[model samples]
Target: MTGKRGRPSVSEALARDERVVDVVIALLTGDGIEALTFDRVAAEAHVAKRTLYGVFGDRTGLVRAAIRRQHAYLGDAGDGSSDLRSASRAILLHLLGDEAVGIHRAIIAAAALHPSLAQEFYDEGPGRAQGFLASHLRAEAAVSPELLFAALLGEPHRRRLLGLAGPPTPEEVDAQVDAVLRTFGLLR
Candidate 1:
């Protein structure tokens, strides 16, 4: 019997996409974005180059898809809680996590040469996180969500990027989250 002419079943397609993104993330973390090529991704992902082209079109599209996949946790609404502090802590935790730190380093290094990727990263990663936090904050708060996020990340994030320190421990993340929230008057 003949089968569908185009694409696999939805489940299979999703699984393939997930695998591709996972491979991309691993490459980015291990070798930085400069080393992430479609050829390499296809070889490692065990998907045909044509399949990657069909799903992602090109290197940029594949990188963007990978970034979007990594940002999925940031896109999630937490516990349906209205508390800004809770939201802030969740955002900080995700942002400071090991995977996020690695992706951030890759994006920053990639963006130095590819300016367009900077905008894409901002829109999809930090921009989304900022919007999420802003939605949970009081309108009258003097601090902007962007600044709040920066404060939450602070020097530790920079240190991580520079290979001067490892990903912050959960206690460190909570402390920094509290400090930033307190500074912004989001926490009592």
Candidate 2:
């Protein structure tokens, strides 16, 4: 939608911003961080370069936005999770998905050169996951949310990160979650 004089309405601007971030994520997952640039993203997103700068400030900001968006999508699965078991399973499944793995690979590749981006990735991804689990663990008394988060991902996530494995099926994810919950004595 456009307002007076052909200016984009607020909703249109936000939609365009989302489109730009989607382009950024695609670029990142396809070619890593090096492929992310104002020029290329502007062209791929079909938006003005100035708009990218205006909204994201610079390359780091753009990267941050993309990472956050990906994390949010992954975290959404946990929104309806009420108990520890459901939340743990949802978080594990979401984190093990292809997009999550690709984002993880991209961040790891950029970590040494861009420490801030690495930190951003941790905060948005694992940190948020840990916090999500923590909320559900409030009644577990002895269970450590951080440890549970680690255990949930464990070797499966390692295999995915190394490209030695594909996304696990629901049954596999359920088994992994049950095993981890059993280890924590939290399975019901």
Write one digit per residue (lDDT tens) for candidate 1, span 1-188: 65556668989899989999989889888898888888899999988899999889877787788767655655555445547766777766676667777878888888879888778778878888788778777779898988887887788778877888876777887788888887777778
In model 2, the worst 10-residue window by lDDT is: 72-81
> What are the runs in model 2 whose C-alpha is more than 4 Å off?
1-6, 73-81
Candidate 1 lDDT at 74 equals 55
lDDT of each: 0.79, 0.83
- Candidate 1 residues lying further than 4 Å off, grouped into runs, are 1-6, 77-82
How close is each model in CA RMSD to the real structure?
2.9, 2.9
Best by TM-score: 2
Q: Could you tell me the lDDT of residue 34 within candidate 2?
A: 91
CA error at residue 127 for candidate 2, angstroms: 1.1
Whole-model alpha-carbon lDDT for candidate 2: 0.83
Residue 151 lDDT in candidate 2: 89
Candidate 1: worst 10 consecutive residues by lDDT? 73-82
